[model samples]
Target: MAKLDFHIVNRIRAQVARLGDRAALRHQAAGQWLDISWREFGAQIHQLALALAGQGLKVQDKVAIFSNNMPRWTIADFATLYNRCVTVPIYPTNTPQQAAYILNDADVRVLFVGEQAQHDAALALADDCPQLERIVVMDESVVLADHPLVCHYRDFIDTYAPQADVAVLARRLDEIRMDDLLTLIYTSGTTGTPKGVMLDYANVASQIESHDQKLALDEGDTSLCFLPLSHVFERAWTFYVLHRGGINCYLSDTNQLKTALPAVKPNVMAAVPRVYEKIYSAVHDKVSRAPLHRKVMFTWAVNMGARMALARQECRPPSWLLQKSYNLADKLVLSKLRDLLGGNIKFMPCGGAKLDESIGRFFHAIGINVKLGYGMTETTATVSCWDDQCFNPDSIGMPMPGAEVKIGENNEILVRGPMVMRGYYNMPEETAKNFTADGFLKTGDAGHFDEHGNLFITDRIKELMKTSGGKYIAPQVIEGAIGKDHFIEQIAVIADTRKFVSALIVPCFETLEAHARELNIKYQDRLELIKHTQIIELIEKRVVELQKDLARFEQVKKFTLLPKAFSMDQGELTPTQKLRRKVIQDRYHQQIEEMYEESHKRSPRPH
Candidate 1:
């Protein structure tokens, strides 16, 4: 292995040296937030690395972390890297069968699990996974099986750290190479079986350097980590935060974000677009129901904030009158909007799915920088992102510095840079097929760059749907538009081989239920409520308004309101919350067929 000085382990080690007493990690337990100082972070990783070494793990050995976002998860990640072993992260929400697939595929020797569910799942798979040797449960309260392989995290570290020779870990760290495989992140598998994307230290190092140039993060920054660490987006960002000596505040449960945001008051964070969309929808929903005078004031304030935001985007100062109006707007309305997101957001990196332009603009108008970007797991999280100034909400911004992006055949976005993954692990044929003869990685996404270098994604090449009438439709565009409504929670568009676009929608029950009370629409349960004629009309009205800009063929002509949201448990969504389209289509085949069948029964309508 060729040696490298600027690897992740060494970077964190340097941070420990420079910022010993400062908090490197933070997490909530019981009712209080706790900090892990840089010194403590380094020490825990050292102990864990020695412990892993004592377990007979060698260089390139695969170690899996099956856990939620917590301090231990990060520690285990860095510790695995410190041993020069490949770290594989399993989504904490994965079923036992799913978890077993990754463990057996990677030949994972040691599995670190987080709560009782993960621990139980690991134990169930141990006998089937012949190569698996140990299970370290991070949560102490998890009841262990009567198996010799099972051990508490505390016991594992304490027993093995002293027995292991420190020199072995040192030598392994010294042997660290830029080309050494750092991680094997499995794709979300929206289309098919998940493939392990092989990313090396060079991929990560390149990302750090690129982000340093495009974004700003200093030692004083605090980033709230709520996205699943199993996903490359959050994992890479977390590493970058630590690399910059910034504190990473881990929120194990996203539901507690309501309280955690105010408590932690993090200045920087990264999240999928869904989080921002939900916040935007909720805020607007409340404002729409406010008193008439309050609504008028909000409209005026938003207009002033928008003017200021536009001036900033154009690299010009707002006029004196506009500046005063913006100052008043900031104090009365915009500041309150910012408070919803902790009131100290320097910028939030948004990815994973297309963000609605309206939602993006709203965040900018309210002085919250939601930097929408585009990327995938194979690219190590970010391919392109908006800079601090001069951004178009409709575009994904320019490519990262040192990264080359070109539109290939059929408008596929081709990338060639250090951030590109080495290949799909153990799948040479798959890797070979994905890369061009010229070495550029086929991104499988269709997009074009604007004159100003901003990349705008049109659609996933594989996901585009063609109707019976031969009109092509982008499902995400329709879903993104309608999904932004306050009453809509989740949506899946169905147009392939159909007469016209249709959708399966899951309403925001809380907001819908409140609206039902206002309308005096009484129901015993969600199913009955969604079936109400008035309720259906209410949703249909919003859908019609949202789709006004879409082509007639692209518009959702028919829809069914579902009582329940698409969930991971039902295999309807991936761990990262991306829709498993085939699964959704297959599971709701009857509902989908009815929408088409009902259309055939209707009176002939204009195209």
Candidate 2:
């Protein structure tokens, strides 16, 4: 049932041949939509490959792409593979030091930079990375005249002979094998140093094949590409979209998503949980401030939509009256939610971290399919995702076709399939430690399967906390439970080697401010506002109510209200909005220590 049997290059070539004049990819420039036809895409890739070859790129030479999501990123990626070169992707949010480490580790020779930031990062690493010879800048706005090593993307491609034959590129494509190394994706390194996950042509091809079997995306579909292309989830998902001959809309600025979504009206998209969480919060906050009648109407519509959704999932038709209710619900409320994501979104894939069940259900209740998925960089982005008919908000769904998933020792999720990466590039010991003897990659995530075979992730194995009382706690579970509160924007649970659980909380400033205004409470700034007793009591009450499902020991006993939220720029969050636990702990050591101190003083134990 695999949709693809050939390698990625051939697959893309086939798409170009079959859908020659169609818009294969689209991006906005100078406030206008521009489309690149399949034929043009193919030609650009060919020219870029030859230009790379002219610059002395050889088989297996590492080519680094440090860029935001754009059409040129994919063109450069496929062109590298066309020349039998390895593509090493560096996240756009990565600091210059991080970029230097990857470039030096991968020994990248030619780096394709997207904009001024990435180009500057590459230039900063010039002295450190001896192998890096040329810099191809994608953004034409960047001005670099005196530099001999740097050139605009168009100018770089023009350097190659125009008469270069397509037959030679065809011969090279024929030489490619399924097992040949294709890309090196570095881990986000929340815990420690980043390691490059080695993936081959077979790994990517197999994922596209398996993924197509699970999801029914077709040629007519359009996917919005906004997440960083450096992440495997977006990168691989984009590849699948291209293979299906779908139009890809690239958003260089994530801040423009709210505007872009309605403008593009994409049929499909994938994003991290933060995006949906923000959307969910915005929707609820708006409804909360609405008139009482409007609030009641919205609630009714949501309930009706949920009923209709359940009926559709069970393949049962709703009764005539219920169907009429759902129609009204869609017209009055559900359709407005859909409009936020460009009304045509058939389904949007969410991954990179655990999605709160409340947020997931809310999307479903509004007639939007937020297919919660599970995977890591090592699995080529998707190990499992919701199927066409069976959708579950609590679990990450069944394994992708041709992929095997099972619970191993410590309840860690184990995976075995062609989609799994070969190993960590140049780190044999780390790679060996990551896999079982039989070749199954040990995904460090702890999870179990339901009777219907849905995978429910509990927490990360390494992130599990052990209290001094010898009880193990899943921080993510506690975080997910309380983090969905209307007033709490972000949370991090702390319990390792401690007597009880605690949290560092970031209040939803907007909601908190509105509440403050209603209560006639005034403060100079966020610091003074979070210190207000009334605000603390409000968040505390919400936390207590939310933690009712948690066991006594697992409940957060004490918490500190942070004045600000964790951010990727501060190195406290990863590119995907996952909190960097160690970094956050280190940065807030004073606050964490104070919380434990207060707990000890409040509940002194006999020695």
Candidate 3:
């Protein structure tokens, strides 16, 4: 007897009602304060949902939505849920083919588009998808395509919206159940056509509950959200913030994070490692440009912190002098570094990649409590997270409350709990193959749990590669080295039936200039710089230096720096900005082959 709990949504509804005139949403539109209260926020969704119901839409129907983090985007999402339909959020930058695959496979009958580009992508998809019958644009674009059914966002809601029937609405609300499907989040589709991971209402609700229990704060807490809503981590976290009755301000877009961060000074925020990496690089780059004395002082303090950061408390000597020295360094150097992450930051819940321990330690040394977590799209967002008080620099965190975790024979992380998704939509084969007979989801990530229940993600099962020398090297380690160099943007290692390992690299043009200047060289465009023998030798020399720390097997023997890096426009990088090794390997097969071509000519490479 599964039934609609409405625990989360009802709690938010009550808070909005109580908050009344208090501003619940804020956006800086054209230097003007565009704000809305809880009442208006709830009313827009109410109207949007009622209008959707009036369109003869049935419960559990798929409603696809595409947009950045706008107030209306959130409204459309909750409205779709209140109307008892599945919310299929599409990424704004997704290719038309990827968008078309999701719409057709999910059987999305109604679409809520964002703007001109989104509408054009939908229009391109319309001819291929038979189920899509309506197109509604979210922006103020008056232009309409030649589709048989097209309407502006406002007109569509007004057309299908019903006058509030209090009794019917309540009854409709009652009919909803917790186990009912609430969302179908499509994978980034970097590996293949995106498969929709269908999450139940209870799945989402339980995650919010877990989050509220773990990361509760006083009322009046604020968050600035910029991640794509199509991702479950961002979407679920947003609802949890509303559940906390926290004031949330949506950033204009990813491109506007700098302009938005200072404007909406939030107390709490969550971001992937890339954001933190950029912040770290900015601080380091700026410091390198300071006076010789200041640069030396900064470097000395940072190095002291780095040394202490990688050590466990048990490893520290019982000397107060060393501790005092570290404390002083933290005060002088580390504190300034953390202040860059918005000094008001209570916790930066970083995830979506393996964070460099160095980066984590640099922030921690300065009194900034940067907590790291681990999870996936299939687990309904978060399964393990490092809390502020109880955290380990080396481990991701303990398994989430009541979430059962076990290691498979193959070392794959397996999770069995209410937080796991029902199954992939229209993917019986994938669903069946991806699970155990008892229904535990088999996470393809390789990991292990210590006696204290702390989890350590080791490597990805699908990404492990072996060289022709029969020595295995984790590509991430090599890739991490490449990433550490400022000039390197995106890189993928090649591991085939070959004698040695090689890499395809894309240089960061902005950073490349400074790197070239350091070496007293000149270059024009990206292509010219990458192909220059001197610049190539500089990167190769760095690679040799880095490989000195690695084993002979782990060393990148030969490398080809590409003119362009993986872009979202290309199918090579995930929307989260993770490297798609397989796609890159496929794209640059010839370049990889050249690395081994002159290997015999190697002047006895250093291990």
Candidate 2 per-residue lDDT over residues 330-417, each given as its tens digit: 9988998889998999889999888988888788889888788889999998888876565666788888888899899999999999
User: What is the RMSD, in Å, between candidate 2 and the native fold over all Cα?
Assistant: 2.7
For model 3 the local lDDT of residue 373 reads 79
Q: Runs in model 3 with CA error above 4 Å?
A: 1-6, 162-167, 300-335, 518-520, 547-549, 599-606
Q: What ranking emerges by TM-score with the best candidate at the front?
A: 1, 2, 3
Whole-model Cα lDDT of every candidate shown, in order: 0.90, 0.87, 0.76
Colliding pairs, model 2: none
lDDT of 1 at 332: 91
Poorest stretch of ten by lDDT in candidate 3? 1-10
- Tell me the tens digit of each residue's lDDT in model 3 across 497-574: 668878777776777778778887777777887777777776777677755766677787677778876887777788
TM-score on alpha carbons, each prediction:
0.98, 0.95, 0.92
Whichever of 1 and 2 has more lDDT, that candidate is 1
lDDT of 3 at 398: 81
Q: In lDDT terms, which candidate is top? A: 1
Residue 229 CA displacement from its true place in model 1, Å: 0.5
Please, what are the lDDT tens digits per residue for candidate 1 over residues 1-607? 1225458888998899999999999988789999999999999999899999998898999999999889999999999999999999999999888989998999999999999889888888888899998999998789988998899999999888888888999998877888999999998788877899999999999888888888878886999999999999999999899988899999989999988999999899898989988998899899989999999999999889888888887888889999999999999999999998898899999999888888888889999988887888999989998877887768998899888999999999999999999999999999999999999999988999988889999988988999999988999998998999999999999999998888999999999999999999989999999988888888888888888998888888888889999999999999888899999999999988888885555311222
